[model samples]
Target: MDIDFLKSQLEDHDQSQLLWYWESLDKDSQEKLYNELKHLEFSNINGYFKQAMEDLKHASDKIDNLLQPLPTEVCGSVTGSSPEELKEYNRIGLEEVGNNRVAVLLLAGGQGTRLGVPYPKGMYNVGLPSKKTLYQLQAERLLKLERLAKQQTGKHCTIPWYIMTSEHTKQATDDYFKQHNYFGLEKENIILFEQGLLPCIGFDGKIILANKDKVALAPDGNGGLYRALRKWNILEDMEKRGVTNIHVYCVDNILVKMADPVFIGFCRTKKAECGAKAVEKTVPTEAVGVVCKVEGHYQVVEYSEITVETAELRRDNGQLTFNAGNICNHYFTLDFLKHVSQVEQENQLKHHVAKKKIPFVGDDQQIVKPTEPNGIKMEKFVFDVFHFAKNFAVWEVLREDEFAPLKNADTAAKDTPTTCREALLSLHHRYMLDAGSKFIHSDGSSLSDIPCAKKAKESGDCQKSENDDQFNKCEVSPLVSYAGEGLEDLLSGKKLVPPVQIVMGPSDITPSIIQNVTANGTTN
Candidate 1:
């Protein structure tokens, strides 16, 4: 059992009490706890705890002098590009997809603690008509994208989906996909690998025990992808599958386009080693990170790190100077990822500390969930590696169409379950408007204008406006049409009412209407 080795290591870190229950545990329990203790990475626990505690002191510091807007050439947007340019980008992106050169990486290690759920966020159903979870929706989108790519490029394609989970969420997430038969995706193509975990430490720099037999551990954030990839040989697997370009994104964005052709095409044409998909911040005080140059290096400057004056700065074109709001969507070259993953310890990304109301077992052998922050969990943000990119590009998308994050439960005012569902519905409603569909009341009154009538609002984001509530309740399944395409065949010249749901056959995505609301907003 290497008793001396274990004792010396724990004693060196002053964490010897971690094995307080070792003698009392049964053989199987002792074996489990021993494995956990062996992989705790406690050699540098003291260093990590000290660094975490010291980081809080400068957490609010601002670097306004170093902050500058992303260069025009490095930034591409739907508003800036002409229709021909966008189409060309989509073609290139689809060509890459059809050639089987693209892969998608989903960062979904978080438990739904903030959302008041005991499972992973990807398993959450935001009250959609189909009651599909985030993972299912994304899987369907990928299926559609593969079909679209094959149709466009005239070649068979498979866009591999790699999801990163954590110790707390891996089993649940793994079982979910298995139970649903991988949501129509190939079981092998959808790879599930776990990110690294770090031990949570209390104020005294001592490791907190979840119970007498276990340490309180937390996932080391999305930034741990680099290390995890190396550890799990994920990069080698991607290479084996012939994936050259990777699209990495968070799993919480309900409107996230899976392996978005526009984003992939933009980065491919620019030959960028790394790229970010961002939304223009309409409000200067919006609580989102800005994709800007920090000290001449491309990085996402946190909202808390920028001064009010810096955020409020406007350009000659009457746009916010620092407008590229990061959405945790990115593209990376496989070679660049490999290079980053192999860096030595000195050049590793810094781990940021998160203070939380950690749950732990007291000396009295009872579990206690603290109401106040009692411990720190060290993590690395995925964006922290931006500075390592030699050629970085930013693609701007409409906020309403591409970036409604799901974080909190329905109780929160923003980024809640209700809000996420509404965002997807509103975007689809606008898609129908563009496709020559009209929203009609039960009595044949107009609830919304037809396509040609909306001149000033070309993007169809007005459906998300505070005054309009009808458009927010409708839903268009991803299988029917991805990103509003192919809707013309179904919704063109059609009259639809509020709270309608447009879906297709589960096994086959042929255009079909599933349900429509009556006068009382419920289907008969």
Candidate 2:
């Protein structure tokens, strides 16, 4: 190690304390610590810390009346579009896919700590019949979508997958995909890349050391995506691959539509350089960020940023003025990415500070976990770049069909494994019904499915009696129906019952086998 250079860098940043124990540590520890310090890139930590500390005091924006609903021309929805419009959009989107001009980007840097797991969140299995991990399900959906596009355009194409990982998930995620043979996807089409990481610091604007040998770090949120992409030449790679439009989404959304044709089609139709997939908020205070114009620029404003009265503000149609709930699903044209990457400092995405109990070297000269927040982690949300879009748009999608996020374990009240599974099963049930399929009991009596559970609850009858009927939750394979399409021939006018797994063979949809579904949601 260059002792003089290391000492100079540390002294310059007021982080020489990292080397305070250097004289006492063995040569091996010295080498480890030196190497860690050598690789750090937080030269602007002081400036960022200063700004974030001020934000914590009061980062108020005066936009009470300036907020406007997403303009009509820039907004489209599955609920609002007519069948003809949807068909046309689907056709246009598939053409882009079949031409290999579309790519899917996944933001999957976070771990599954909230979900009670040590692995990456994408590796989670959400208790479906196939027991598929989030990654596998997304891979299969892409595979199915490619085939669908081919069927529509008569051109076979491979959809490139760009997964953004972090220090915590990079190696494990790479290994998991390799072990699973890329979940029936071509290895060449799947690209896993690491995002940037920022040094975690304390309230006093000093770097925190995880151990005697290392500086503590955290993934630089999803917004670090832009800088990482530029650093790794992801933009150049996308250009070479002829990927004109990119669909980016979070990994935890189990119901995410990978390389969604309709969304891409809608954005393309509107000539949108950057776009987002929004869901109408269920209620005024639903804890979702609203996608609306702030000072004439597109951005997602958090619910807490506005007053309760402003949140409850309604439009002429009685819908909340800020009803476009941000689901972190977005579309970016290649040109948009290029410009955003090369934009001036005033247009760049800014990092937000979050208080966390970061484990660090403590009083006894050992790494310790604090019971309360003791440090800050700087992060940049991917949507923070929306303000840079020259022509932005928002596509509203059905929350139940497109936004089943898996944030926690089954123990959490919402966004749990159980809730995700039920949401999927319920959506598949609706798909079956739309395909002219029916569910019946063993004796031909009509059966109630998970979707009916909500109706039953509204009618005060969700709880089962000693003799009430059990649910026949069915799982629809994505390879069979990417969005409930192409299923009429196999499932139309069919009487299905009990637990069924509707999957497709190499050529066509196979006959589903029936099994008894118990009250505990297991199949017998």
Candidate 3:
């Protein structure tokens, strides 16, 4: 093998370690590298190698630029679609609800570190009626959706759940779900894959080696979903399974609409290579990426890119413009995914790094907090793939019903247990009101102020409100609570319904519990 020739050709001023990397290779490995280079004689070695080196440098530069405090444009507000556009989407959604070619790609690699839990994000119980975990809710939704598809179209819907986990939580996550029997879901349909990680670099840009042969690394952000799929050969697996349309989402959002056939159907019917779920911002400055045209091409502008002037832009009717806030729910066809995955492995997409407080050890046996930022945490946004799509579409959805993210600690108040509880109760309250129940005060009289369960629980029985003519001693159960569906069934009769308590995994409803103030009862 021509070792020196190969080394001379590859040595460069920027990468002084190339010589060390070559020296680390044994004779057999050197011969192999020489053979590989000889086989690529047809390729422009100098140009290709130089470009590869420059790409890494350029990516490093992008990170340096990112360090400068991001502008307000990094977040964006939501923009509601016209009523006519919404009507059109609704029509398309209903038509596509019956298609069996859609599947869900759930990103579940995150740990509940922010929540101070030692389990996967999917395992955190939100303290709902059933105590059902996030995974159960999503799994049950797939089950219900499949049944709905069969009932609506008379065709069997096989919606596969493609879950992505990380080295940190793979074994425990799988074991946790298996022990629970996947919450009555089909085990064969659940596919799990592990994402890749890159070594953390020090402030000097040198890779931080944790041990003699291993380096400390972290999961390449959720943006690496495509590469993880390719690395695990999941993209090819999906193709063989007859899945063309993939509805992908993160697992933290409790109210996410999963494997939404309507979204898939709309993408398919419209022939879109990629599509995203978005919501109109409550104001013009909410923190989220906005979908809009960049340099005459469609792209998502991170909030930091939007200035106050850009956010304040309004239409003729004085409504704030630029209102498409990405909810992280996306749809991509197999062909398009294939393209993106290929680019991902080839390092084609632009890379951005973040500097964080990575813990380390000092000579004095104390943990060191380096004053200067060290190491780059690489992340690939799912939106980054949009730039490669031949055609992309954005669909606006109702944020109030579907965008509560379960991130942060309890005190964060964004997606904490308390916040999720409130959101769920709000949904239930609307359902109850739709069923003709009136709100009552503590004194057993109807109240003008809408009663929140947090406050209502302190008062008295929710069913014993004033002006109870609409309900007459009928027993109404949530059949499906915010925790999950198919819980307790509602029983209707002539009398107003009484307050109800729900349980799970038990067939026996103790006589002591329902013995008082109840009416007719029903079971699922």
Best-performing candidate as measured by TM-score: 2
List where candidate 1 sits over 4 angstroms from the true fold: 21-27, 343-347, 450-472, 518-524
TM-score of each prediction: 0.92, 0.94, 0.73
lDDT of 3 by residue, 259-339 (tens): 765566556555788888878765766778777656544567766666666776776767556777778899898888888
- Window of ten residues with lowest summed lDDT in model 1: 462-471
When summed lDDT is taken over every stretch of 10 residues in candidate 2, the lowest stretch is: 463-472
What's the ranking of the predictions by TM-score, best on top?
A: 2, 1, 3
Q: Tell me the lDDT of model 3 at 206.
A: 44
lDDT, candidate 1, 194-264, per-residue tens: 99888888888888889877788889889989889988999999999999999999999999999899899
Query: What is the C-alpha local distance difference test score of candidate 2?
Result: 0.84
RMSD per model, one decimal: 4.1, 2.6, 8.6
- State model 3's lDDT: 0.60
Give candidate 2 regions above 4 Å deviation: 59-62, 343-347, 448-472, 505-524
Candidate 2 vs candidate 3: the TM-score winner is 2
Candidate lDDT values, in order = 0.85, 0.84, 0.60
Total colliding residue pairs, candidate 3: 23
